[model samples]
Target chain A: MPRCRVRVSTWRRSVVGGAGGVEACRSGEVPYGGGRFNGQEGSEDSDSSVNRKSYPTTLRRHPSRMDQSESELKRFMSGLTLAECVGFVIIILTIVWLQYYRGGFAWSSDYKVMFNWHPLLMILSMIFLYANVMLVYRTFRHERKKKLKLVHAGLFLVIFVMAVIGLSAVFNVHNTAGTPNMYSLHSWLGICTMVLFACQWLCGLLSFLFPGVRHALRAWYLPVHTFFGMVVFILASCTVLMGLLEKAIFTLNDKTDTPYQFLPREAVVVNVMGILVALFAGLVIFLVGNPVFKRLSLPEDEMLLNEPIN
Target chain B: MPRCRVRVSTWRRSVVGGAGGVEACRSGEVPYGGGRFNGQEGSEDSDSSVNRKSYPTTLRRHPSRMDQSESELKRFMSGLTLAECVGFVIIILTIVWLQYYRGGFAWSSDYKVMFNWHPLLMILSMIFLYANVMLVYRTFRHERKKKLKLVHAGLFLVIFVMAVIGLSAVFNVHNTAGTPNMYSLHSWLGICTMVLFACQWLCGLLSFLFPGVRHALRAWYLPVHTFFGMVVFILASCTVLMGLLEKAIFTLNDKTDTPYQFLPREAVVVNVMGILVALFAGLVIFLVGNPVFKRLSLPEDEMLLNEPIN
Candidate 1:
């Protein structure tokens, strides 16, 4: 493989000097595009006079540690795979608890049964799909930024639809049954997570996906966007845990056969499912936050950095 | 203010090249010590020959942006202050919930009353105090490293003692009341948190507080220490939320007059307390994780980086 040269210009240095500079650089702000590895090096016009001046002074390729980086990349891939599996397990566990124990899902036919769909769909959309969306950039580190952005937006749209359906399931159950809505802590946090999530998604679309957003604004909003994505995901996880606890206690108390305090098999499964959701959330956050797993800046990214398209 | 000179040598570059390089540097590995600002410039012996060769190439001071950084620092301080106040509110709410609603705490007189101490003490030690301990490094960014280390360890010691007493309160209540322990999800998670907290504190004491560890090991362990620190704190928060849900349901179910589903005044207070705890934990984690609030490296840290005492 040919070596990829990295040129650190004066303008780039200045951009990296302030509070969010390093994070911006890491989040594809610094042009380290993947085009160089595809033999497209030096093809782009060096139109920026600033880049031309600092070209010779800071032109250097990192020492070839292909073997080491390869191993590390493999480790990262394995970790991602493990996170996906754990997420799948959580989804399955939820289904088992709902289908086998709580008498499977239905809509309008049985209000009690309809409530089961709430947990299942929530674990699928809010926890499972949300986590996978967070991992998409890391998973496709070499993909074009424009393509990845579209994929991200598309996936979020799907997640939003599923979340709406999940919310309706619980609300319908409560409304039809004449039970007070948003009375529990779980309901309160769940609504908060959903509201914040919708706002986050709308803001992301307007600021990032739309062409009218200014480069400066996008650069400034990137860190805030990243921070809230993690926050909303975590809040959703906590809400689900509380919901599980509420369901378990209500179910066990209403039925004398399986008390929650006795550690019934169903209770154990519910607890394990909650634990798995927390673990999955933690792993995704760690993987996303760790710099080692960050996408390597490509030569083409340098142009984007100067022009500010992404 | 004196301008501090930063010299980035080849050896330092290599150390920063690996997976954890940036984090290590941010955590005080690259030796951008604070002595220069104190008029101690060039006082240390530059015995390493590598430094001599790279001095001309990398020796440069960041463009003095004292005004920019100063305001940013103020913003960070304000954010921290808000987090602290939120944490204090969580503590106050927990006390009010326990003292006003649940009969006040006692050692062994009434098992039900004794259980009240468990939540109060755990909130004090595990949630409130733990968040403060995480903030100490950022709070005293310019303090001597040795001094900060002692303070960190001392704070952890206090936290540990309170956590132990908190654990005993619930155990005594459970044993005396003949109720099974560790049966619910909350108990399972609470025990997991306490055990992990103990292991983390002990490992921290041996590796950091003691003098025998190698520089390489300490350097490697620092990132792990920081990651697990955040993880354990989050797990603790999740556990506390579950425990609150359990208590609210059990208390409401046991007392027919105040059903949890009816959303009584006490139930609302309990739910509000849970939400406050989650918000406080989120704020603490955000303040601790944001790079903008990181402690500035000092000139004395350079020597420690080279010598490896920390």
Candidate 2:
């Protein structure tokens, strides 16, 4: 009975800590010190306020704020790790399914090989890099705001380069295959998202990072900036999803059977990749929007603001 | 010059009143009188403190609360009308595209006819009704909380009935065609969403509406309920999007041409419908998430609580 109680308490900790849900049932968290030190066990309620008031100074001899910060840290780490794993799975499944299962990728092998680079590079740039850009502020809350802005700008620049390369791959495939470019809804949406993404990056840099902009103007633009940042990210995600389904039909059109015949291994993998990518985007949006998991803005971070970059 | 100035000021009023954003640009209000009273304007900044200090009594020549409430009313009205239009458009376009362009709907004339009802009913239930469920709290914020809960419960029951009909149509079509059911990723995700939706409705009814639940327990469950409610709505939207793509390919696959050939009229309409549905979902999610546009909570809303229903 005692063993079961200990095991249950550990499971609850990791679950409440936001890392290992039922999926990661092992609930692995290396105990740093006294195993029985956390006196705030047995209560499974998720009321942060209740926990704060009841368990303060009881869980440890440390300050209540320290205990709260630790929990917040655990939540942040767990959320990011889960989101990262999902993002990586999307990339890996897309590449493996396209490369090994269909045909391997090559520089200029054929339309098929060229088409393969489209999903891989686009996912890498749009989903992975764009997600990191959204997360930079939250992840490095302790860092100087000006430094984080530079990092954010730098990451967006990388995304621009990757996006150009990815777009070229798709256009190259279209030209080689004698297929018309921007003919379908997918291509239209994809190109629009890319163009808007470029414009958004340039606009963000000019408005936020560029020197000589008055503080009042920057403050006025802040809400619009945050709104568009999220909007553009969502647009990119929508375009990617549209591209996934468009590609699925193009590659999996079994004339002998119905279209999107998921009985086939490749089709199933394609659909799974699409769902996983959508879920990853959803998780990213959730993490960014939720205040409880957001990083605490520090005094030094605020002081570092208004420092212009070249 | 005075006429032009009046027109400009009217436009500004609508804009500052939160009804002129792209998502709510129709600015449709019932106009319950007292037209030129709101004096909160010309500041051109979103600083809440400035607004509170400047136009506290000037607007409507009444209490500041009245001014804030009027703006909230405008927002609520505009948001609802816009969502209603989008929801109706989704239903109408699905019907027209499937009925007029793709040979029209029938009960058992063919599998295609049976499949037509699937999209229509599913959109009505999943997209339309589910979205309204999210908006109800915001839309009817001044209503008694018990009454709103009843309305919510009642609306969900309607969705349950519609969902049953939608599922039956798809299953019947599959059975008649002698095709396996629940095989594709679309089907898997759709079914999972439906099951979860049902469970959510039941759990919400039990915990929030039931008489036996303690106040502390109910408060503890509120956040979880709110979180899952949004999550399930998102999942449903995602499933609908997948279904749109799946159905588009199945119907638009021209053997002689590339898959999803947009030259076909039906194909173009289908793609347009998909994009519109996505935009609609995006708009709905945005309105629900934005606090500035949220409705003002009422005092009576809190008193009538924990009433059981059939």
Candidate 3:
């Protein structure tokens, strides 16, 4: 076969077919034309039980002297099992301990922030945010000019911004520079962020359903998918905010627990977020329909031995 | 062009594959996958921004002038814009109203159930069970045999059994007619469900990192991707149980709330869930790394678009 002399760097991006500096945005995931794999004709014929156990039919046979195998095994034998047993015990102990110390909900409205369980929820929020942020940062470092870089950047900006906002709220300092109600700003940015978030999901939906969108944004692969992850980050911060706010409003506990006092009154944000989430869910269902249901199962998502569909 | 006497039905089936099943599962918008023939290469790339913003775009364009262009014009006029407007309005109103109605979190000792804020959440559990059971029925409906069907059916059966146990706990009606915690049977199933969920996400992750899995699964395809989705279904159901358990303990309110009379004396379960959720969050991070602020801007992903390398 005659080989085409394509530059490694040049060919790296020859897939999506976008334009200018923004070459990453190519067609959607679906090709304008289609393909030829038909699965309908002999649909899953099987005589096995519904929950068929592993059918690891040995397809190859290699003769090995049992004596040699035993001797080699003896050479590799260590206290591996014993170590694992101890490790398992440690994990159980850790979980049990957490249940005692940092277990259940604890919130107090000693601040004007009123109803924010932010401090309490921060325990989980911090872990999630810190770990996720680190992973995202490292991925960026490794793939600098990667396909979907814009998408990755767009998502990280959102994550950092939220983290900052959450921290300030936790410490009772305004992080947005110049803003009071975080209400109006939060409402506008939240809605816009929500819209962008929807676009991110739609991009994936199109990748599987529309083709053009998939191939349009370069390979549009992982980076863009990472953008979809922005949702989880937003969720963590918001959940923490909700938890914190719960304390602020209800004064679940007073100075007896911490140093803070309640403001006037405001306890409606959680409901707003819940409504947004539910509505977003309904809209996704409407847009993607039945296919969306299958995707909703994050666990089943592993069946995707192929790249993640969305 | 030579035309062979081919069965169009078979050809279409082969071409469509999992998309056909998804099509069966979803509703398609009129444009199919949009128009404009995608323009030709070397025809000069238009500003997608301006092109996107052009008011020439209209929804519900009723073009009755003539011929094929007539349908095209009509479609152009009757496009996505206007329809989305109406949909957006409805979502806003519903969410706002729901938010207005949701009161502060309430506690209950009897573990009866709280149906206010999470009204649809509990119903979602039922819907999940309903969908699974129906799919199981469909597996056995027509073509008498299929290995994949049976395997998936086995999956559904496990879900069904768990759901039954869960429902029994909720309504106080188990087959054995036990007094309480009938749903404890579901907890054993939870481990299996979590494992399966991990498998699904792993499949998705591997599709990207492992070329063998990608090539074999055609990491590019959707059908192969949906396999992971099935596992995701069971995992999501497990969360419903968590939600219910959370609600049960919610009756206790916060530890800071009161003298602890209205609260359920059983505080152990709440603590257990918190630690479990924390551990789960940690595990999920291990599977899908965190998103945050770092050298997050990537460029490799942008190389695939076949455009000017920035």
Candidate 4:
């Protein structure tokens, strides 16, 4: 496996040569590359002493100096937690909007009901799970880089599968009802988002995961990948908002007893849901973009990551 | 008047004590704080030699090192230009959508035609003008900071006025037609965007313009201001998209001869317009958010900015 190819000797050399010096990380003292490259693949039980000893002298030198930075870190953590909570609220709102106001979900038997699955599944795949995947690196900074990559890729895969199903549900309903598909602006943008997302995932996989590229190439591509990830996420979010508006207008028009323009109960719920989705997307982007919240690379982690494995 | 209060002696002292050393910028060599705080307020003629001479030796030491960064800066410039082009295209498309597909604009004479002004003016104010206002700092990085602030505030004031007219157009139509107001999700979110935009403008004025806050408070609020600026822009974009969808559905639904679902010419044009708006917004956000494109503070500018006059 690629994980095993990371040379432990290189890490040791870098650590010994680091500012902490060889004396700081003597034999059997730092637990050999901080238990990450010690042939313990997938082991979650990392040694606490390794973490403490691996910190650079600059960080450990002034405990009082870290108070402001520590509080900033805490704010970032709380922001992330709040984003997750908002995400779940959006999910719950979507469910309630579909179940209580509109009819509940179904399969091919009921085309209208099948359309309900589209919004729920797309929100789950595109907005909620996709946001979490973007946060994995920032969230689990202490974890092994390889493990975090695995989790990121794995969540993306799940999102892709759900997105595919979501697309299928909408297409199936359109075909069954003999209605035109991909005609509206929502569908046009939605298709673009989907294609870009798939391409982003593939690029990310090739660059960072299996059959990884060279270190120089990976470094060059990393920022591009991150930039496109945010772009695709935003495109998806906009598509969803448009889709919600379209669905709300179509289903709650003048033909209905309580039309959308009348500010009916269901219309208000859908509007709130759309607003929440936008809020969630905005918060996630802010958390990712703010430099203060960025995940700092530890010395040991950097040593391991910089190894010329690829 | 506030600009005159900046102490030029402080900048001279800081420049003399800088790493380039006093020898690099002797008396009459640096042109006295690079001609910024020399009471020549609002003068557009900044000395290019002063700019070249004021650069730190670390930057000027390696000519080859400047090549890559210079190319990156060129790319950022080109990206901003491209975003501006896209924004203009969006405005033109909105005008066409309003004038050609929908009826032409009017005042109180014809409520239906008056409604047409809403989309065109909203797009002009919120999308086109707003994006350009955000790009002013990056576009005119070498300009006097106070002049840029004035330009920024001036452009925003224009946007605010246009937005007010845009809102009035819609409200006038709704009132004259005896229809409801602020009922749709589009109107709700649009109101939210307008309110937030006004508040952001006020905060910006109070913090950076007349009677400015303390430097420390301004520093703390700068990022918050920037973060909210982006959020409000995105919210505005979303609202515009929703408004487009609402109008398209309302005017081009099954009740019309060629419904929206039929992929009519108007529908396709509207869809393309919406997509262009999204692209413009995304490109603007990228141009603004990408760290590579951030406006670098000149040494002279830093000296003047760091003055404790505020």
Model 4, A1-310: lDDT tens per residue? Answer: 0111222344333333332311222211111221110011111222222434545565333434334335655676778778888998999999999998778988957898999999999998899988877877556644456667767788898899999999999999999999998888788889989999899889878877745366656655665677778788888988898888888888888454978778888888888988888889988887766544444333444434345533
Look at candidate 4 and give me any clashing residue pairs.
none
Give model 1's clash tally. 12
Model 3 over residues B1-310: C-alpha lDDT tens digits? 0111223343223213211211211111111111111110000111122222321233112122112222332332232223223323423432342344223223333332322324232222332332323233121211111222233444544644544444434444222233333122123234444455445445534543333442324323323334234324423433433443434323444445541223233333332332233233322221121111000011122122233333
User: What CAPRI grade goes to candidate 1?
Assistant: acceptable
Residues A100-218, model 2: lDDT tens digits: 86687887757787777788888888887788777776665444456767887898888879888888998898778777676565665576667777777887787777766765566
Q: Scoring model 4 with DockQ, what do you get?
A: 0.25
**lDDT of the structure predicted as candidate 1:** 0.64
**lDDT digits (tens) for residues B228-305 of candidate 2:** 666667677767766777776666664455456445676677767776776777677666555444332332333436
Best by DockQ: 1
Q: After superposition, how far is residue B177 of candidate 1 from its true place, in Å?
A: 1.8
* Overall lDDT per candidate, in order of appearance: 0.64, 0.58, 0.28, 0.65
Error of 3 at B56 (Å): 46
Candidate 4 regions off by >4 Å? A1-60, A299-310, B1-56, B59-61, B299-310
RMSD of 4: 9.9
How do these models rank on DockQ, best leading? 1, 4, 2, 3
Error of 3 at B198 (Å): 22
True-structure RMSD, every candidate? 9.1, 12.5, 25.7, 9.9
- Please rank every candidate by TM-score, starting with the best: 1, 4, 2, 3
Taking the tens digit of each residue's C-alpha lDDT, what string does model 1 give over B1-310? Answer: 0111222232123222211221222221121211111001111222122222322322222122223334445666777778777887888888888899898878876988988989998888889888888777667655545566677778888988888888888989888988888777777778777778878878877766676577555544555566678778888988888888888878886896968888999889888888888888878777776653445434354344225444
